[model samples]
Target: MVNAHQTFVIVGGGLAGAKAAQALRAEGFTGRVILIGDEPAPPYERPALSKKFLLGKEERESLFVHEPAWYARHEVELHLGQSVTELDRAARTLTLSDGTRVHYDKLLLATGAEPHRLDIPGTGLAGVYHLRRLTHAELLRGVLATLGRENGRLLIAGAGWIGLEVAAAAREYGAEVTVVEAAPSPLHQVLGPELGEVFTDLHREHGVLFHFGARLTEITGQDGMVLAALTDDGDEHPAHAVLSAIGAAPRTALAQSAGLAVLPTQRGGGIRTDAALRTSDPGIWACGDVAAAEHPLYGTHLRVEHWANALHSGPAAARSMLGREVVYDRVPYFFSDQYDLGMEYSGHAPPGSYDQVICRGDVARRTFVAFWLKEGRVLAGMNVNVWDVVEDIQRLIRTGRPVDTAALADPGTDLASLAAPAD
Candidate 1:
């Protein structure tokens, strides 16, 4: 419980949870912080797990959140391998899997999500995999190890970032990879079709097979081994291993059990949260992939499952929990490096969100910067090779200032000159 000193119990020890704990300490919140995580080890980085680690390039220990001394130096009670089975909001306590009750005056729920598994007929068969945690990557790493010199066949179940990243890694490990997505284009709704085309070509160049607008129906096994996954598209193929990367649903069971109201989002997944990252119950907060935040810029509730969003939202929620009012309306940004392309995008430009599309370079040459323009204002910016455009566009979007959209489209115009001087 919280005496004059605040005792905070944070559930889930992924990027969000670790960032929350770090934020509390960074803000001089040195009362008593207990990070309750279900994983056996302390919090570690997750992004590189799919990239460098999966390719067998990164060492395992390099992923640790920080040196062991960092947690000790911050005075945070690091509870590793502990499962918080139930929440006792009435008593302001949590019952661990071991039956010990831990008390807290304030609680931060950063319970990151698990991958959405396919309901296909053979999904439960051996060699079917899910990628969301370090353990999941380790399993795939082991599978790739068993491949020897023979090219492995990998069928990735979704076209999201996780699926595509895993595909890149599989290709690096001498595997033939196929990406299947029900959506018409990869990250289409978020990045819009213009940029999605850029990615379509990129994957094609890498010799990655794409089955767009096709839904998987069954993952059938042969002799207890995962051999083929039939699709709604009437195609059946063999894959040595299948990775279900359909993304994650919000981990809201804890909030729901704690008697807090959980609202479903418009985007077909995740929990709804206010501007301050609080659920219906003020004492509890949610962030990371789980929280659907009301974005002031776009005038919509944006649920971003990106590394930058987690880094931003975690600290934003911690500041709110510490009684500081913070608005998290930054221009959303995410980047992925695949097959010699340093792809990056910031802000969102759904269809009709922008009236005009501005181009700064040639897409035919496979290098350019593009801007989404709405009423002479920069709505979003994407870069395939020229990334400096994002920095200027990010500033222009945050202020909602009028820009010279015509000049910016010419490829020679300097974007920074379009913004109004700061008052």
Candidate 2:
């Protein structure tokens, strides 16, 4: 019953959109596929923008999800640098920025997210930067090198993943780096105080300065160039450059304008969708950072902004679009690399959600598995410098069985064996 004349229009040219298109063709869908993006370049992975790519260890070409020729070979109509300005749900059409009307039998909104800009003065200064795009990374790579050579200082706002990774890269370049965070510790929101202290100590050992419990209030500049950053605590730090890495907001304007329901800001705002990634409009679907879909495991709508989410959810949404039964219950996952520490975190354990965080192996040596437990049941786990245990950790969380705390923390016990036997 596949309609050869059917057309599927996908908005946003990030990893999710690209993967969805790939999935459609892989699933033998003969329908027309049109992919549109605001960025001029084809769909690329965002993780490298803050890590290897920013450090100059990765090439620009390596960031793309697929080779440029792959799209043409797949017969996907690629439209770059043109944003869909209007979504007419009634007419089943999208009006691009260039005034071209594109009709679609099914619509996919993979419109990712944009970095949160600071409302403070001097954000538009020459040396003030944000790194949410490939072009931004390209610009920052050169700037960090110049600052390193001059022994210049980099004042970074927010100590999240992006800020910390950039600090690591800048230190590798021999640049003086200082981070300003409102939380008491770096990654305080994600890792909590105990584990967040590990990262704080790690960066300090690498010569990165931190000003905790304070945030940037203003950026002072001269001749439209950044000079220094003034913090809320009335402290001023001299800087040749400043990076605003507060966070990102999902791009949901198109969904909202089209009368699609979106989660409230408190619920990590994004277009609301069902377990199958189907939005309020039956003909439209959402995925990746833009889709706050109901997770079957959690029994709640959750929006995850990570590379893995986009990597898997894209294909999952594609299957749903093809009328396949889909329930997105993938465990939340993300990884980070800073200095010599490489860590992968699986499952959700935001602050109060976990009762205690237990560790296996050596914490001081930076080779350990930290598990967040609630009522003796594992909710999330993070392994630093440890490999090949993600499956066990995810399994523990999925089983929802309370584990023996001592056995769970003992390196001698096998994690897979800790889960209860199925009936």
Candidate 3:
């Protein structure tokens, strides 16, 4: 049982930390809650930074997880722009960057992740940028605005989700966009080659250029400003500005320094946690992108960086902190918006785990639902330009029963009926 007077210290003021604080209050915990974030801004949504926010379709104020007034009303202490430099877990204390010491009865590490930096030369050039925060997005937005319509050449590194989304935004803004990806196809690792081709076609139709299976040998710049990117194939792609859309690495220095058990780098670098979101230490917990939590459904540890996982895992972590018998078994789900395409995916199946992909609807028209099946069992499902079926897809995965491919592919077959016992 948690004492009402004990202070709860939450590190990392991202969406997870903010949601945990909200959950603490909602769960009737009256203790002092101190949320620490290194950034100057309050906790805000990050997904939009690469999409609507970057394109200026969403306002800055709309990004916040909760308004400033909400924090004040909830009595949650906001420690903005201060980073915890030293965490003495045994002493139950934290030393901030400004030499302030804070004591906590319970600690939650929501350190999230940092954008993976490219070690290639010329990355420090003036027009070279990476997006991970609101400020980064703001800067990119400014660069895009200054470039005007078809006046700027934008070179993007990596074909991951972030890189692809930013490419869409840059192209939409009329910038000449070129994406260089190390993989053979954009999103091939996640969506598989066939489905991945759908996005490749979408981008090509929008005038976005792609260089697949290419390596970025170097970024060339003049007068400390980006000018072009050199590829291993001895080709140079000229650009006025560049954005590194390569993925992110989990921020686990705090947990590592504090003597917590973290997953090996090969297994996915993150603080190791059980199904309840509890770290190796009894008094400490970790969630969001920083936690590699075991999932009952998959029987494996997964560290998901999507928005939905952070939104749900934070609250579940808080409940577990209060000694509740909670299991963080929620199905992992993520969505992306690029060009005229909107896709939602649920479930976790490692690459090569699924034997076949069963599709419903029309793939040529780019309106369809694709299921990753292993031995006739649905391992995961993705809906593209399709609506009102995510719940059914998740249900099919949760049930863990072999599904009839014929029924699954039949457009007339109701999704809910697919979950029924095999006849």
- List per-candidate RMSD values in Å: 2.4, 1.3, 1.7
Off by over 4 Å in 2: 1-4, 420-423
Residues 1-423 of candidate 2: C-alpha lDDT, one tens digit per residue: 335599998998999999999999999999899999999999999998888998889999999999999999999999999999999999999999999999999999999988999999888899999999999999999999999999999999999999999999999999999999999998887888879989988999999999999989999999999999999889999999999999999999999999999999898999999999999999999999999999987778999999999999999999999999998899999999999999999998888888998999999999999999999989999999999999999999999888899999999999889865666
Candidate 3 has which clashing residue pairs, if any? none
Q: Can you list the residue pairs that collide in candidate 2?
A: none
Please tell me which predicted candidate would have the highest lDDT against the true structure. 2
Which candidate number would show the highest TM-score if scored against the true structure?
2
**What is the TM-score of candidate 1?**
0.93
Cα lDDT tens digits for candidate 3, 1-423: 334588999999999999999999999998899999999999999999999999999999999999889988998999999999999988999999999999999999999999888889888888989999999999999898777564899999988899999989988888888999988899877877767788888999998899998888888988988889998888899999988888888999999998999998887789999999999999999999999999999998889998999999999999998989989998899999999899999998667888999899999888999999999999999999999899999999999998889999999999999876566
Candidate 1 clashing pairs, residues 3+ apart or interchain: none
Error of 2 at 12 (Å): 1.0
Between prediction 1 and prediction 3, the one with superior TM-score is 3
Query: Which TM-score value belongs to model 3?
Result: 0.98
